[model samples]
Target: MLTPQWLDALRARITLSAVVGRSVRLQKAGREFRACCPFHDEKSPSFYINDAKGFYHCFGCQAHGDAIRWLTDHQGLAFMDAVKELAAEAGMELPAPDPRAAKSAERRASLSDVTEAAQRWFEDNLSAPIGTNAREYLAKRGISDASARAFGFGFAPDQRQTLKAALPFDEALLAEAGMRIAPEDGGEPYDRFRGRLMLPIHDARGRVIAFGGRTLAKDAGGAKYLNSPDTPLFDKGRTLYNLHRAAPAARKAGRIVVVEGYMDVIALAQAGLAEAVAPMGTALTEHQLELLWRQADCPILCFDGDAAGQRAAMKAIERALPILKPGLSLGIVRLPAGLDPDDLVRERGAAALEALLSRPQPLAEALWEFERDAGPISTPEAKAGLKARLLDHVGTIGHPDIRALYRRELLERFSALAFPPRYARVFGREARRGEQARTSAPAVIDRLQQLAKGGARDGFGLAVLSGLARHPGEISRHEEALIHLARAEPALGPAIDALLALSETLDSPAPSPISGAIGLPALPDRNLYAFLIEGNSPDLVREDLAEAVSLLVEKPALKAAKAAATARFDRDPEGSMAEQGRLRAREMALDERIKRLGRKRAASPRDDSSRSPSPGAMTAQATD
Candidate 1:
């Protein structure tokens, strides 16, 4: 026997991608790995491996499962064989079989028999002459005959001992299976469900584990929908209606539609959307969400357009926040006002329902909209309340990266709402100024002259830094190279650091009030280059600036190579000195290139496209 804890430990120790990749050729696809689904043939890669989530799914064929399931399905290994192989690979020992556990397992297996027997009996009753009202109710609800049979629709007669007398199973087994209600006062035990249109709820393996019933009588006094009690065979929280059927279709469709009830699921299925499921007459549980994620990355939650539906959506959002991962979240579809999925599909047809399903609101944006419209933000106090509520939701997120991103995105939305005019004015002017300055030779000259004056030895370095500070937006393109230069050459570290700092404050390469606040190196002696004068091409200056950064970035690497040569002299003196000479000459050649930068501006063709800095031409970065 293997305990669940030990199985989990074994699974935790195995990397799913490492196991899957042994047989499939995987390519890096963002946070997950993708490959052609080995289970089925396809041209484009639709299969994905997410090691973080520890599963593989094929959007094409709907083949999905964990490592153990993979071995069983793909390789045709038996359950324990797969488990034993995985455990051995994970360096885990199997647990010894326990008599109590075996007995409990046997009891659960026998209870399944009871549920299965009850399911057949109910189906027989629905087909019998006495089940006319249940059949009429199903037809009125637009449930087709095919759907009734496919979903195993049945009827429980309006009598206590109808099932008790029908099935040969003992009363204890019936009570244990939740098919019969045992009396607490030593009275006769009766059927749990009576006079209802019954639908069997299945486990993930498609076993009939429990029943959910809708009363057929017009004046029925109880709840409209009633579910079986928690029993050994079924835990409502862990079971989703139509999961076994929906899981496969969800994979093929690449999305799962979560409706409110099993009837809605059946209706959607009849309308050709077979990938729909529902919770067991309760708010979505964490276990149900996990099951949904196993079939699809982001299951679209389609709630009704009424108030209770919105509340259900909000509750689901709250439930999902703490467990959200990088690629796993929810998509919300708020149907047309005053309509549920079944209503929309029936009134507007399947196409209308499909349109809504096609365009789902992402969870984050939906969260923002839901909270923003929760109340009017007409006053400062009201706006502050909205902000507080949003932050409160954001705080509940567990993943650090996702939490920080949510905070940033939500706050940015908040800032836009609270102070839109100021940002618009500031960014609008910055854009206009940036356009004007890109071609303004005088403005370019003014920016160059702001840096500290330096001699010829420091002229090129100073020019590059000044040009970078002026085009502060491009700092990120060369951020890596700049950081490398800073680390390799300590003497230039302060000026480089200052320019990097300046780039952060300026939103664009425009003359910014904040840009003037950062310290900058003085201009090189103006006589160092004729290109520094007014009327010189700003375009050419930018090109030369990019080239200068590239040249200066190479210097440290050359120095490090020469030092490495020197370090090796004791062992390979001849080769080391020769290598050193080549490196030194390369350094001189680099120096000549630095001197030729200004001349390149003079002799270079005036191609407008070439003048614009290309990505690899300089490793300059963009704005944060």
Candidate 2:
């Protein structure tokens, strides 16, 4: 894990607008940088990056966070990978690994050297006198020398001592690199790649880390394809084949095509589809999916059109659904029933495979297509099972918006298909339509009315939210403060989320005073909200909401602290007394902070107040 101090330094050292702008094509928009929202397909620009705040938010998708999150979410990098990448860009060395991890890290470097050396040796053999068989095989497959070199294709000679004579490393180190297989009894280790065609597998940085070998000779072995054993440097489950090369192409092409094997990726590349990548002779792994995502939010999975390929696609889908987010997803393409990428490209041409990729089904549709027709739906029990399975898959999604959308869409489809409506004149259409209208209308209205009361049984912490909804513009400015408040006051979670969603949708250019048109999740205390925003100037609302958010954040925080201190009183009186003293001081200081903001409101522009919490600066209540 990256240290907080290092994270802070990284954030501070880089200008977010510049970093995001390089990829997003941002143009200066007022105080922030703006881009046409990349997370969602939109015409007008709604994405903004606030370098001062060290965060970017997509008003379209509600994607908000700092640099680390951008890398993890938008770029599809793992947390540590993102950190290391950002650190490198900032010219900062990562903090030292734990002592226990240091040796593994050091050993991995030695293994990488072995893989690199072996890669060269294999490449040399592909062109050497002993490589005639390999050369002939490539020629027969229509692979040019340039193409083979581009993919780092190589060959392992039939003789076992070829590596023994060529590699400088000893048997022990070679075994660690997955280059040699040691005998169970006390025998010398033998070459692992004898009589095979070799393809070097690279990490995201394009460093050779592993090898995938296809047997060349007759009666050659245990499996058709074998990958390097999972060693310290190579874990097939965590690495994608050709990612180091395909990532840039994926970014430019706006999608990655994930095939089933290294040769498929090579064939696609040969056919001018440079964006294709593959798994290392196994099912696609979660990490590989993430790697694809780093290049494009929605990657295309091109599976061979066979029962095995369908199973592989399903496995990848099941592994990926849990991490599905609002703006990131997958697309699927099943090749013609019995052919793979290489076969398709070879038989018809690049255009034929390109045509298949051009028409990709959404993951939801793919999931529905697979599960819906798996068994008969004529029986209600089977239909119910389909619905249950769909719900289960949707439930795994982590993002609230995507989860909700998937559920709604899937359920609606199930309801229509499992229990289709009757003719309009008969009764079903009119009756069901009326029922749905009544069911939905009262639901949202009654909930809002109850929330506005702050008195009914269904009260939803409405007071803080009504004021927030009336001044959604303030939500972004006070997000951190609100996040802290949300933690201390769980009851306000729904309201906070609603306000955030509404605020993100609000337009820039300094919003007008709250109107009835401001969509809110729940109604506020009507009289208070009306008095606060009706005919109020944008500046006045900013001042008022500034104070409101301050109070909302501080009051709840202080109250929680007091309650906590009181609880600890029975156990640790002295500590509780000290805590109580600190809370009281913070409470008073919070009052002072509010007073200072009030004074600043009268004297300065709205920008001064709207600038999000400055570096190392916090409201007194937050300090507590």
Candidate 3:
């Protein structure tokens, strides 16, 4: 559990606008802002923002939430993790977690300790007698002694008990680190990567999370390359080897060079090309792509020029096309035949590899590779097939303008083949529709209302309501009318109470005089008085009282009325008369009208029975 102070600090750090702005193109609309929903493919913008309330709602998908909820759901972070991320973004330090959360923190710390211990043990073993063959193999591969130490290169002895006796660790702990192999005979555990040159894999934060090892001998009996098993600290799909070292170089170079193996990264770094990373014997995942995107505008994937490497590059391109923004690029660096990055660096030297990096193939050239090997487009059938394939590739590209330009280029390329005009028209229409959907305002408002009504029941509801309070301008008058209904009925009482509680938690001293900020609208004073007059359920009445108190605390006019009411209650403590009697009489008349409305509701054919009394009637009766 996060402490109140921590939660407050997180709130101050993150806002809905900042979260939405990163992925979507947001434009100001009145007091709020609007953008297309990134969670779903939308052409028209159905996502809305109320900066004042710090809330966002998507009309199309019915997604609604505050900043924290948005980050948790959109970015796939845990709730507290989202809080911490926002807190960090705001440059604020969070307080210690609650007592219950301390146990989780302790467990995490222990895992870190275990990982650090394993890394140290591996580093120490690099120069041990058992690592002689590994050292010889590295020397043969042109890896210097200094480079080996710099990368924590090491060896796992073939003996089963060597690792067990080397550290005060159990088999379970080794297994947890993905470094132990279980015996068939229930014997002692053995090393997972024997007779191999080890490469410690660290995460983005430079923690030794996992390992990758290369076979030093031809008859090592194990696979050529073995990676650490999936553990709490490592997910092969998500972790790129050498990202810790490559990130700064990638940022400095304004491009990342992705390779295929531990040696590829090590060899590149040794060759003075340090901005290279590779997956741990797996295809690139979106998580890894996001990490790369954060570091640079363009990433050059350097794969071997073999068929398998080409296929892998195509797959990576497909995975990235949808998420790649306008300025962001994905270029391919196809190495010479029968050569990986390491072999290329060793054979041709760093200057040759640097030349290859300089002449990267653009994203369009990679996409064109699909058409290069296809059948001739002179025939009608071939033309149709080519057009269809081209449209499919173009459609996968996320940006509308880019997709259209590619489509035009495809048509020009196939002009001699004589493809149907309908194909081009259809693709163009789809791109147009996507653009239209991203800019529409009414669609955003409709989605916001739908989200506000239905989304309030989920775990993210309070956050959504808080966002609404922060950004009321994104919400339309019609939507507000619907929200107003929540205050009049018992079914909506809990939701109202939840919103009020969330608001109370947000109240703090204004941070250094707000600049050009719109505040949330004042809650209706008459609504509160009406709820108190009517004999509603206790829960409903209590919520009404709370909401009234909150509003009065903020509004000067309402505060004075509240003081007068309190004075009347205090002055007529014994008499049970005075302004209280007048208020009760007004309450009785309002109750009669409510009963009449109830009878009318029972006779009406409408489905909704939660309508409130007419405002004019309530106001008239209050005056009487």
Candidate 4:
């Protein structure tokens, strides 16, 4: 655990001014500095940085936090990890981890060691006989040896345990890194990537977290390309290959060229078009999209002109619509027919690929492809169906003005299609329906508020009710939202109770049970709850014994009840059947309640009391 003095020192070291100045142009506003918020799309500056307070607050998005919090949220670092990063930036050494944190740190270190070992083994093999074919194949593909080493290309030997002999890492650790197989018969570990070309996957911070391997042989058994499974350090869905090296170049070019494979990214970079990344075989996920969005203003998705590639590009566009805004754009760079990015760069030279990237189609042009490819709308029914699909796509756009313009464009396009005048009415009707849907959402919010104030039987339920009542329209019925809230406020049992009541009252079924809802409290109530439960609880509660005690004991004051039961059981030794039964019931009830409370405490998070009121809070107070 970080001491208060250490936290204060760390806060003083990396102020909000430093963070904002690096990303945004700031103007002095009395004691605070103001700039356009980096967290969202904004024209006028609404982000305020208070250097004296070591925090930042954006009036536009209601994003307010200290330096560490800002780094964690904006840069996507884990809380303690963010703290350490900031501390390192500030030239401060981190204190030794406590027992619990020590174990976690050790596990992370083990994973890191495994990855580093695998990376070194691959690097060594790249020059050896085992990697000769892979190296020659790269040369044939026009990848220079210098470029190959720069991007850390290597080859995994066909033989098993090739890496095991080279590194001091244990088999279990290698298996965790997605490098070796865990044996059932206590046999020696075997390589996971046999007879494949290796491309080391690095995090945004440039640490080798995992690897992506491609089959050398056309008839290779398993997958054509294999990516590392989710481990302690790498999540394939959240990672973009070559992002670490490409980020600076992408930012400089004001665009990121997203390709489909490891070779596409490497070949582009080698060809001197450095701003390129590839999805790890999966469709462009929202997580990957957000990562790219953070690096540059616009991201150009360059895929092959083949049917599969077009389908992938469209999927990417659909995934990005909600996230992409005015300054942030998504354009498509269509390669020549039947040619992938790697093939184009290899044959036509890097200049041709770079020219295509430089002259990407506008977002509207790419979005229009969705309609163009769907076939013509000659009849009224066809036009109506088209308009509905277009409207759904427009609705997904986050910007209202952008959505409205697209709606108008859809109407204009339909008019051009020579559809009857009645077809234009379909666009108007769909726009009205979208408006109505937004208006109807408040009704759900109002219902949740009513449930919260109704004082449900469960105290935990009432607490949850109170929270939902506080943010009526903002909350969602999705399990993710609940889980997010639970993580923000560990002591959200009461709030969750209210949510449960709201769910029940609305005749909606509760979804799957999420145990860690209270893990990292996001709300003020949740944060308070976590502080109380984790920081203030006795050793029993801290040890997760509270749940067992709650189930065994009865009533609200579980500690007192447990004490009474224990005394009765001790005095009688061979107690009466009725007395023993009563004692057992009390004990069980207490255990259940403790568990419930523990879960609740984990869900609700408290706001940092050390910081002053944010701009929004001050304005709210003034209004009140």
Residue range with the least summed lDDT across 10 consecutive positions in model 4: 615-624
Model 4 Cα lDDT, one tens digit per residue, 46-105: 989999878888888797999877655565455776787788888998888689878987
Task: For residues 37-59, write the lDDT of model 3, one tens digit per residue.
Answer: 76556788888999787788889
User: Which candidate has the highest TM-score of all?
Assistant: 1
Global local distance difference test of model 2: 0.72
TM-score for candidate 1:
0.62
- Would you give me the overall lDDT of model 1? 0.77
Model 1 Cα RMSD, Å?
Answer: 13.4
Per-prediction TM-score to the true structure, in the order listed: 0.62, 0.59, 0.52, 0.56
lDDT for every model?
A: 0.77, 0.72, 0.62, 0.66
Q: Which stretches of candidate 2 lie over 4 Å from their true place?
A: 1-102, 422-624
Candidate 1 — which residues are off by over 4 angstroms? 1-68, 71-96, 422-624
The residue-by-residue lDDT of candidate 2 on 109-217, one tens digit each, is 8888899999999999888898899889888888888899898889998777779789999888999999999989978778998888899998765789999988877
Q: Count the backbone clashes (under 3 Å) in each candidate.
A: 16, 1, 15, 68
Query: Model 4, 7: alpha-carbon shift in Å?
Result: 6.3
Residue-level lDDT of model 1, residues 165-268, one tens digit each, is: 88898989999999988889999889999999999998765789999999987888898899999998799988889987876566556788999988789889
